[model samples]
Target: MWPASRIPFQGRGGADFVEFSQVQDPSMSHKVQPLSSLDDLRAVLRALPGPDDTARAAVIAREPTLTKPPRSLGRLEDLALWLAGWQGRHPPTMKTPRAHVFAGNHGVALWGVSAYPPEVTVQMVKNFQNGGAAINQLCIASGVALEVTPIELERPTRPFHQDAAMDEDEVIAAFNAGFTEPLDGVDCLCPGEMGIANTTSAAALSMALYGGPAETWTGPGTGVAGHALDTKIRVVAEGVALHAGAATDSLDLLRRLGGRELAAMAGSVVAARLARVPVVLDGFICCAAAACLKAFAPDALDHCVLGHVSREPGHQALVAKLGFEPLVRMDMALGEASGSTLAVPILRAACQCHAGMATFAEAGVTDRV
Candidate 1:
């Protein structure tokens, strides 16, 4: 069952909101006033705590004795240690894994930036609710609970090529929405997003943060090609140009170039890190959120795991710029937490290996010469 404090945000068809309430930290309880501005949001982010160094050291020490040729497990060994560091356990276990899929619509969708219609956003959301989505199937198979949060699904963000996606109050509200639910018992989080043409926003944000031409970050979202692809690239370039000043600061860039779903995901990343829960990142949309989170809270990535490098053209550059090595690279473009859910089983296996594998001494096996 979901925690009691979770609230639903009203959308066109129904409420599309879920949040983790009753966060465990005492510091988190000192209620700050409603976030009215970016500075207010930054202050909340500033109060977030970083990962535990002592716990990371403990995991590093234990890795040498895990009854294998040292580092033979490769990334799994690294993942085990990484998870241990944030979990503050000698051998971390995946006790509870949850996925949050944030869905919204971009006004840019009206500009023909995607091959699919904007209504697909609403339809896919229903698919997720009905357990007919790929992410739903995968989360069930992996024993991970999934929560799909629809942020302003009835109202799409402003066409970013012409104006900012949302006003400051709306942006702040969406950001705060991520922290409204209680996440006390969640061991890890996977953040994903759904919005037709959101790739344009992500690409614009990527260009703003990573300093590249819009074409460099633009991709064929939903399989648009030829002149359609050209339109996407042009729209992103124009959007970035229109918001050049907001690009000067991370929060401002997000305000100008990001959609409601992106901002909510960014807020979720901050909330997860402050709660000391490790985050497993999905593709480009998740990466775009991470980029903003890094700016506002630099240590947030310390609690993150890159689930995969997406088929989106911009994702490769963003992942490289952020210095992440993802666990999967299957060229997945399905943006409903499918990639991250697939990686949850690997994380559980890593935890199981670390906790249950016997040491050489216990196994009575001689060490290699």
Candidate 2:
């Protein structure tokens, strides 16, 4: 179930300057007061088209190039349609695209379910802050705005350690905490994860949702070997059993294994969807959190774009179930959306191709009809 804490409807903290203001009607110069309703004009904008130069160029190329005989551009025509539908028009727009990367560690890592140490999450977070991480560099090159969310979901307080465990309320309390900024006007957002041993948490969560072997989804996380990998699988299996015994709620599941970074990513995705922004997913960690949001609102899946194929065994299973295609195939295990950022330029180039090419008529080519 979702938390009861409300996102205030009227207070536009981050979007203060974005709200519409009243316009003067010079024709009715009698100095009369306006309707004082912003909704009147905003309503019209809601029905208008959504697009940027890339999308509009796609519109000009709406027609397929026919063969001298007949029936050409078969697959290309269909691809155009798919892109159009996403924009709610004939040409899809890729505008103001950006990425949001959330990072955090998991408490379940103490159980030996993963190969990496938790300290690496902190190290990576600092790396991201300094713009040294792969995701940071790729996003810079791709012209994708990046936002790093620092979450503390899986981190332990002095009161609750792994030995004592936690109940539903404790988990829910952690989720009630909010992010510092809003994700509006971000045409496309991508969710990434950071936590050294997070694959253990990911495998456990995948098992809970999909019910498969711990080994089935487990993979070489941060480069662990034979005996260590075996130990990691065993630990994940045990943690799954432990969480099942607790009979935790959805939020509880998020807090217990999803980690704080996962929660932040999940929350940001939800917020962005409500604001009508699209999101691209990095790897297993983002996919795991996407599953959580999928439980709340099935439509949220519409906004996620698949980034890359992960070396982690479970990533393929999760992506398949989510019904998305991974854009890249590198063996990326980094917690950041480095893989997705790498593919952003390709998407941008695709949009550019759609926009910059001349139409059949513009080029003065005769129609075959």
In the order shown, the candidates' Cα RMSDs to the true structure are 4.9, 10.2
For model 2, the superposed segments whose C-alpha errors exceed 4 Å read 1-91, 157-181, 245-252
Candidate 1 lDDT trough over 10 residues, lowest sum: 1-10
TM-score of each: 0.89, 0.72
Residue pairs clashing in model 1 are 19-181, 20-181, 20-182, 21-181, 21-182
Number of the top candidate by lDDT?
Answer: 1
Candidate 2, lDDT over the whole model: 0.57
In order, the Cα lDDT scores of the candidates are 0.79, 0.57
Candidate topping TM-score: 1
Residues 188-220, candidate 1: write the lDDT tens digits: 889888899888888998888878788899999
- Model 2, C-alpha of 273: deviation from truth (Å): 1.2
